[model samples]
Target: GESVGLHLPTLSVQEGDNSIINCAYSNSASDYFIWYKQESGKGPQFIIDIRSNMDKRQGQRVTVLLNKTVKHLSLQIAATQPGDSAVYFCAENSREGAQKLVFGQGTRLTINP
Candidate 1:
Protein backbone atom coordinates (compact mmCIF):
# COMPACT_ATOMS: atom_id res chain seq x y z
CA GLY A 1 0.00 0.00 0.00
CA GLU A 2 2.21 2.82 -1.26
CA SER A 3 -0.62 4.95 -2.59
CA VAL A 4 -1.01 8.52 -1.37
CA GLY A 5 -4.50 9.40 -0.14
CA LEU A 6 -4.00 13.09 0.42
CA HIS A 7 -5.42 15.09 -2.55
CA LEU A 8 -6.40 13.04 -5.46
CA PRO A 9 -7.14 14.40 -9.02
CA THR A 10 -4.40 17.12 -8.95
CA LEU A 11 -2.16 19.48 -7.03
CA SER A 12 -1.67 23.25 -7.20
CA VAL A 13 1.70 24.96 -7.55
CA GLN A 14 3.12 28.38 -8.17
CA GLU A 15 4.16 29.82 -11.50
CA GLY A 16 7.88 29.98 -10.72
CA ASP A 17 8.86 27.49 -8.07
CA ASN A 18 10.21 24.01 -8.00
CA SER A 19 7.53 21.31 -7.97
CA ILE A 20 8.05 17.82 -6.62
CA ILE A 21 5.51 15.29 -7.78
CA ASN A 22 5.20 11.92 -6.09
CA CYS A 23 3.85 8.49 -6.97
CA ALA A 24 3.25 5.38 -4.88
CA TYR A 25 3.25 1.90 -6.28
CA SER A 26 1.77 -1.41 -5.18
CA ASN A 27 4.15 -4.03 -6.52
CA SER A 28 7.38 -4.92 -4.80
CA ALA A 29 9.27 -6.72 -7.54
CA SER A 30 9.40 -4.13 -10.28
CA ASP A 31 12.82 -3.54 -11.84
CA TYR A 32 12.89 -0.88 -14.51
CA PHE A 33 11.97 2.68 -13.50
CA ILE A 34 10.86 5.58 -15.67
CA TRP A 35 9.33 9.06 -15.33
CA TYR A 36 6.90 10.63 -17.75
CA LYS A 37 5.28 14.06 -18.08
CA GLN A 38 1.83 14.53 -19.55
CA GLU A 39 0.16 17.80 -20.36
CA SER A 40 -3.54 18.64 -20.36
CA GLY A 41 -5.32 15.94 -22.35
CA LYS A 42 -2.10 14.76 -23.98
CA GLY A 43 -0.14 11.52 -23.91
CA PRO A 44 2.78 11.01 -21.60
CA GLN A 45 6.25 12.12 -22.68
CA PHE A 46 9.40 10.42 -21.47
CA ILE A 47 11.47 12.70 -19.35
CA ILE A 48 14.08 10.48 -17.75
CA ASP A 49 14.75 6.85 -16.99
CA ILE A 50 16.97 4.72 -14.81
CA ARG A 51 17.41 1.01 -14.58
CA SER A 52 17.34 -0.96 -11.35
CA ASN A 53 21.12 -1.18 -11.48
CA MET A 54 21.41 2.55 -10.89
CA ASP A 55 20.09 4.70 -8.08
CA LYS A 56 19.89 8.16 -9.60
CA ARG A 57 19.70 9.85 -12.99
CA GLN A 58 19.46 13.44 -14.14
CA GLY A 59 18.11 15.14 -17.23
CA GLN A 60 18.16 18.72 -18.53
CA ARG A 61 16.13 20.18 -15.68
CA VAL A 62 14.78 17.05 -14.05
CA THR A 63 16.22 14.41 -11.79
CA VAL A 64 15.05 10.96 -10.77
CA LEU A 65 16.29 9.24 -7.69
CA LEU A 66 15.35 5.70 -6.83
CA ASN A 67 15.53 3.87 -3.53
CA LYS A 68 15.35 0.17 -4.20
CA THR A 69 15.95 -0.52 -0.55
CA VAL A 70 12.63 1.22 0.16
CA LYS A 71 10.83 0.52 -3.11
CA HIS A 72 10.23 4.22 -3.54
CA LEU A 73 11.04 6.73 -6.29
CA SER A 74 10.72 10.48 -6.74
CA LEU A 75 11.01 13.24 -9.34
CA GLN A 76 12.57 16.68 -8.74
CA ILE A 77 11.84 19.58 -11.05
CA ALA A 78 14.15 22.56 -11.03
CA ALA A 79 13.09 26.11 -11.93
CA THR A 80 9.42 25.35 -11.81
CA GLN A 81 7.23 27.27 -14.27
CA PRO A 82 3.78 27.16 -15.78
CA GLY A 83 5.23 25.29 -18.72
CA ASP A 84 6.45 22.62 -16.37
CA SER A 85 3.00 21.98 -15.00
CA ALA A 86 1.76 18.57 -15.86
CA VAL A 87 0.92 15.16 -14.47
CA TYR A 88 4.15 13.41 -13.54
CA PHE A 89 4.19 9.69 -13.13
CA CYS A 90 6.69 7.07 -11.96
CA ALA A 91 6.18 3.74 -13.63
CA GLU A 92 7.89 0.39 -13.30
CA ASN A 93 7.69 -2.75 -15.34
CA SER A 94 6.08 -5.78 -13.75
CA ARG A 95 8.54 -8.09 -12.11
CA GLU A 96 7.06 -11.45 -12.97
CA GLY A 97 3.56 -10.93 -14.33
CA ALA A 98 2.58 -9.32 -17.61
CA GLN A 99 5.74 -7.25 -17.53
CA LYS A 100 3.72 -4.19 -18.45
CA LEU A 101 3.94 -0.95 -16.58
CA VAL A 102 1.61 -0.58 -13.63
CA PHE A 103 1.26 3.12 -12.96
CA GLY A 104 0.72 4.46 -9.50
CA GLN A 105 -1.84 7.06 -8.51
CA GLY A 106 -0.72 10.12 -10.50
CA THR A 107 -0.40 13.52 -8.87
CA ARG A 108 -1.80 16.28 -11.02
CA LEU A 109 0.77 19.12 -11.01
CA THR A 110 -0.80 22.54 -11.32
CA ILE A 111 1.04 25.81 -11.82
CA ASN A 112 -0.32 29.00 -10.39
CA PRO A 113 0.10 32.60 -11.47
Candidate 2:
Protein backbone atom coordinates (compact mmCIF):
# COMPACT_ATOMS: atom_id res chain seq x y z
CA GLY A 1 0.00 0.00 0.00
CA GLU A 2 1.12 3.55 -0.66
CA SER A 3 2.12 5.70 2.30
CA VAL A 4 1.95 9.32 3.35
CA GLY A 5 4.67 11.06 5.38
CA LEU A 6 5.41 14.40 6.92
CA HIS A 7 8.52 16.40 6.22
CA LEU A 8 8.89 17.34 9.87
CA PRO A 9 8.37 15.36 13.03
CA THR A 10 7.40 18.35 15.10
CA LEU A 11 6.55 22.04 14.92
CA SER A 12 6.30 24.83 17.45
CA VAL A 13 4.36 28.07 17.14
CA GLN A 14 3.78 30.96 19.46
CA GLU A 15 0.29 31.74 20.61
CA GLY A 16 -1.76 33.70 18.05
CA ASP A 17 0.67 32.72 15.31
CA ASN A 18 -0.21 30.67 12.24
CA SER A 19 1.31 27.30 11.46
CA ILE A 20 1.69 25.15 8.38
CA ILE A 21 2.15 21.38 8.32
CA ASN A 22 3.28 19.60 5.19
CA CYS A 23 2.80 16.07 3.91
CA ALA A 24 3.93 14.00 0.95
CA TYR A 25 2.01 11.05 -0.41
CA SER A 26 3.25 8.24 -2.60
CA ASN A 27 -0.03 7.49 -4.30
CA SER A 28 -0.89 9.82 -7.13
CA ALA A 29 -4.22 8.06 -7.56
CA SER A 30 -5.45 9.22 -4.20
CA ASP A 31 -8.43 11.50 -4.64
CA TYR A 32 -9.78 11.86 -1.14
CA PHE A 33 -8.19 13.30 1.98
CA ILE A 34 -8.88 13.78 5.67
CA TRP A 35 -6.76 15.77 8.08
CA TYR A 36 -6.82 14.58 11.66
CA LYS A 37 -5.77 15.97 15.02
CA GLN A 38 -4.92 13.68 17.91
CA GLU A 39 -4.36 14.64 21.48
CA SER A 40 -2.92 12.54 24.21
CA GLY A 41 -5.11 9.61 25.26
CA LYS A 42 -7.71 10.29 22.57
CA GLY A 43 -8.62 9.17 19.09
CA PRO A 44 -7.85 11.16 16.00
CA GLN A 45 -10.43 13.85 15.25
CA PHE A 46 -11.16 15.19 11.79
CA ILE A 47 -9.98 18.77 11.26
CA ILE A 48 -10.52 19.44 7.54
CA ASP A 49 -10.26 17.84 4.12
CA ILE A 50 -9.69 18.61 0.43
CA ARG A 51 -10.62 16.51 -2.55
CA SER A 52 -8.50 16.06 -5.62
CA ASN A 53 -10.85 18.19 -7.68
CA MET A 54 -10.37 21.16 -5.39
CA ASP A 55 -7.04 22.82 -4.74
CA LYS A 56 -8.03 24.20 -1.39
CA ARG A 57 -10.72 24.05 1.31
CA GLN A 58 -11.22 26.10 4.43
CA GLY A 59 -13.03 25.30 7.66
CA GLN A 60 -13.23 27.51 10.68
CA ARG A 61 -9.61 28.41 11.55
CA VAL A 62 -8.15 25.63 9.47
CA THR A 63 -7.35 25.26 5.79
CA VAL A 64 -6.34 22.32 3.63
CA LEU A 65 -4.57 22.47 0.30
CA LEU A 66 -3.76 19.80 -2.23
CA ASN A 67 -1.26 19.81 -5.08
CA LYS A 68 -1.67 16.71 -7.18
CA THR A 69 1.19 17.63 -9.46
CA VAL A 70 3.61 17.29 -6.56
CA LYS A 71 1.48 14.83 -4.61
CA HIS A 72 1.65 17.15 -1.64
CA LEU A 73 -0.82 18.29 0.97
CA SER A 74 -0.74 20.99 3.64
CA LEU A 75 -2.73 22.17 6.62
CA GLN A 76 -2.76 25.73 7.78
CA ILE A 77 -3.91 26.81 11.19
CA ALA A 78 -4.92 30.42 11.49
CA ALA A 79 -4.06 31.00 15.15
CA THR A 80 -2.00 28.91 17.47
CA GLN A 81 -3.45 28.22 20.89
CA PRO A 82 -2.62 26.03 23.85
CA GLY A 83 -5.59 23.85 23.01
CA ASP A 84 -4.34 23.47 19.45
CA SER A 85 -1.35 21.41 20.56
CA ALA A 86 -1.64 17.93 19.16
CA VAL A 87 -0.28 15.43 16.69
CA TYR A 88 -1.50 16.19 13.21
CA PHE A 89 -1.88 13.60 10.49
CA CYS A 90 -3.06 13.54 6.89
CA ALA A 91 -4.86 10.53 5.48
CA GLU A 92 -5.25 9.75 1.82
CA ASN A 93 -7.51 7.37 0.00
CA SER A 94 -7.73 6.42 -3.63
CA ARG A 95 -11.55 6.61 -3.43
CA GLU A 96 -11.96 3.05 -4.51
CA GLY A 97 -14.84 1.24 -2.86
CA ALA A 98 -13.86 0.23 0.66
CA GLN A 99 -10.26 1.26 0.17
CA LYS A 100 -8.18 1.82 3.27
CA LEU A 101 -6.73 5.24 4.01
CA VAL A 102 -2.99 5.74 4.39
CA PHE A 103 -2.04 8.03 7.25
CA GLY A 104 1.11 10.11 7.50
CA GLN A 105 3.49 9.62 10.41
CA GLY A 106 1.97 12.48 12.39
CA THR A 107 3.70 15.78 13.12
CA ARG A 108 3.47 16.98 16.69
CA LEU A 109 2.40 20.61 16.90
CA THR A 110 3.30 22.56 20.01
CA ILE A 111 1.81 25.89 20.95
CA ASN A 112 4.19 28.11 22.82
CA PRO A 113 3.01 30.85 25.08
Candidate 3:
Protein backbone atom coordinates (compact mmCIF):
# COMPACT_ATOMS: atom_id res chain seq x y z
CA GLY A 1 0.00 0.00 0.00
CA GLU A 2 1.29 3.43 -0.97
CA SER A 3 0.84 6.49 1.16
CA VAL A 4 -1.15 9.35 -0.28
CA GLY A 5 -1.47 11.66 2.68
CA LEU A 6 -4.86 13.26 3.22
CA HIS A 7 -5.74 16.03 0.82
CA LEU A 8 -8.87 16.82 -1.14
CA PRO A 9 -11.51 14.19 -0.72
CA THR A 10 -13.01 14.49 -4.21
CA LEU A 11 -13.66 16.62 -7.24
CA SER A 12 -16.55 17.01 -9.66
CA VAL A 13 -16.52 18.10 -13.27
CA GLN A 14 -18.96 18.29 -16.14
CA GLU A 15 -18.58 16.04 -19.16
CA GLY A 16 -16.73 17.23 -22.26
CA ASP A 17 -14.71 19.71 -20.21
CA ASN A 18 -11.18 20.08 -19.00
CA SER A 19 -10.05 18.86 -15.61
CA ILE A 20 -7.08 19.76 -13.48
CA ILE A 21 -5.78 17.74 -10.56
CA ASN A 22 -3.25 19.19 -8.18
CA CYS A 23 -0.74 17.34 -5.97
CA ALA A 24 2.05 18.14 -3.60
CA TYR A 25 5.17 16.07 -3.09
CA SER A 26 7.24 16.04 0.05
CA ASN A 27 10.48 14.94 -1.46
CA SER A 28 12.43 17.61 -3.25
CA ALA A 29 15.07 15.05 -4.22
CA SER A 30 12.64 12.97 -6.22
CA ASP A 31 13.65 13.18 -9.85
CA TYR A 32 10.86 11.26 -11.53
CA PHE A 33 7.21 12.23 -11.46
CA ILE A 34 4.18 10.39 -12.84
CA TRP A 35 0.44 10.80 -13.06
CA TYR A 36 -1.83 7.76 -12.71
CA LYS A 37 -5.53 7.16 -13.07
CA GLN A 38 -6.98 4.35 -10.97
CA GLU A 39 -10.44 2.97 -11.48
CA SER A 40 -12.73 1.92 -8.66
CA GLY A 41 -10.97 -1.35 -7.88
CA LYS A 42 -8.37 -1.83 -10.57
CA GLY A 43 -4.68 -1.03 -10.62
CA PRO A 44 -3.40 2.41 -11.35
CA GLN A 45 -2.77 3.24 -15.00
CA PHE A 46 -0.02 5.60 -16.05
CA ILE A 47 -1.14 8.75 -17.82
CA ILE A 48 1.95 10.89 -18.18
CA ASP A 49 5.33 11.57 -16.56
CA ILE A 50 7.97 14.23 -16.20
CA ARG A 51 11.44 14.34 -14.79
CA SER A 52 13.04 16.86 -12.45
CA ASN A 53 14.85 18.40 -15.36
CA MET A 54 11.68 18.84 -17.34
CA ASP A 55 8.91 21.30 -16.64
CA LYS A 56 6.11 19.74 -18.67
CA ARG A 57 5.13 16.71 -20.76
CA GLN A 58 2.07 15.82 -22.78
CA GLY A 59 0.39 12.60 -23.78
CA GLN A 60 -2.82 12.06 -25.64
CA ARG A 61 -5.41 14.17 -23.77
CA VAL A 62 -3.33 14.51 -20.66
CA THR A 63 -0.54 16.85 -19.70
CA VAL A 64 1.72 16.77 -16.63
CA LEU A 65 3.48 19.74 -15.18
CA LEU A 66 6.13 19.70 -12.50
CA ASN A 67 7.36 22.61 -10.41
CA LYS A 68 10.42 21.46 -8.54
CA THR A 69 10.96 24.79 -6.88
CA VAL A 70 7.56 24.70 -5.26
CA LYS A 71 7.39 20.92 -4.98
CA HIS A 72 4.10 20.94 -6.84
CA LEU A 73 2.67 18.78 -9.61
CA SER A 74 -0.48 18.99 -11.66
CA LEU A 75 -2.28 16.96 -14.30
CA GLN A 76 -4.48 18.48 -16.94
CA ILE A 77 -7.05 16.46 -18.85
CA ALA A 78 -8.45 17.92 -22.01
CA ALA A 79 -12.08 17.38 -23.04
CA THR A 80 -12.65 14.98 -20.23
CA GLN A 81 -15.30 12.34 -20.78
CA PRO A 82 -17.31 10.04 -18.59
CA GLY A 83 -14.75 7.30 -18.98
CA ASP A 84 -12.11 9.65 -17.64
CA SER A 85 -13.75 9.67 -14.29
CA ALA A 86 -11.38 8.04 -11.84
CA VAL A 87 -9.02 8.61 -8.92
CA TYR A 88 -6.15 10.62 -10.27
CA PHE A 89 -2.89 11.13 -8.37
CA CYS A 90 0.74 11.93 -8.71
CA ALA A 91 3.80 9.78 -7.89
CA GLU A 92 7.45 10.45 -7.31
CA ASN A 93 10.46 8.16 -7.69
CA SER A 94 14.03 8.17 -6.53
CA ARG A 95 16.76 8.16 -9.11
CA GLU A 96 18.79 5.70 -7.09
CA GLY A 97 18.79 1.93 -7.52
CA ALA A 98 15.57 -0.02 -7.36
CA GLN A 99 13.36 2.95 -8.00
CA LYS A 100 10.21 2.72 -5.95
CA LEU A 101 7.28 5.00 -6.64
CA VAL A 102 5.72 7.01 -3.82
CA PHE A 103 2.18 8.13 -4.33
CA GLY A 104 0.52 11.33 -3.20
CA GLN A 105 -3.01 11.98 -2.09
CA GLY A 106 -5.45 11.17 -4.88
CA THR A 107 -8.30 13.33 -6.11
CA ARG A 108 -11.39 11.49 -7.26
CA LEU A 109 -12.63 12.93 -10.54
CA THR A 110 -16.35 12.66 -11.12
CA ILE A 111 -17.88 13.52 -14.47
CA ASN A 112 -21.35 14.94 -14.27
CA PRO A 113 -23.69 14.71 -17.23
Q: All models: lDDT?
A: 0.73, 0.94, 0.84
Segments of candidate 1 deviating more than 4 angstroms: 1-9, 95-99
Ranking by lDDT: 2, 3, 1
Task: Give, for candidate 2, the lowest lDDT window spanning 10 residues.
Answer: 93-102
Give candidate 1's TM-score.
0.80
* Tens-digit lDDT track of model 3 for 1-113: 33333257588989989988888777777888888899998999988889899999989998888877878888889998999999987888876888688887688999999
Candidate 3 residue pairs that clash: none
Q: Under the 3 Å rule for N, CA and C atoms, how many clashes does model 2 have?
A: 0
lDDT comparing candidate 2 with the true structure: 0.94
Write model 2 residue lDDT over 1-56, tens digit each, in one string. Answer: 59999999999999999999999999988999989999999999989988899999
The digit string of per-residue lDDT tens for model 1 on 1-113 reads: 33322125577877667776655555566678778888888999989987878888888978888777767787878878888877877788856556577666577888889
CA RMSD of all predictions: 3.1, 1.0, 2.5
Q: How many backbone clashes does candidate 1 have?
A: 0
Candidate 1 vs candidate 3: the lDDT winner is 3
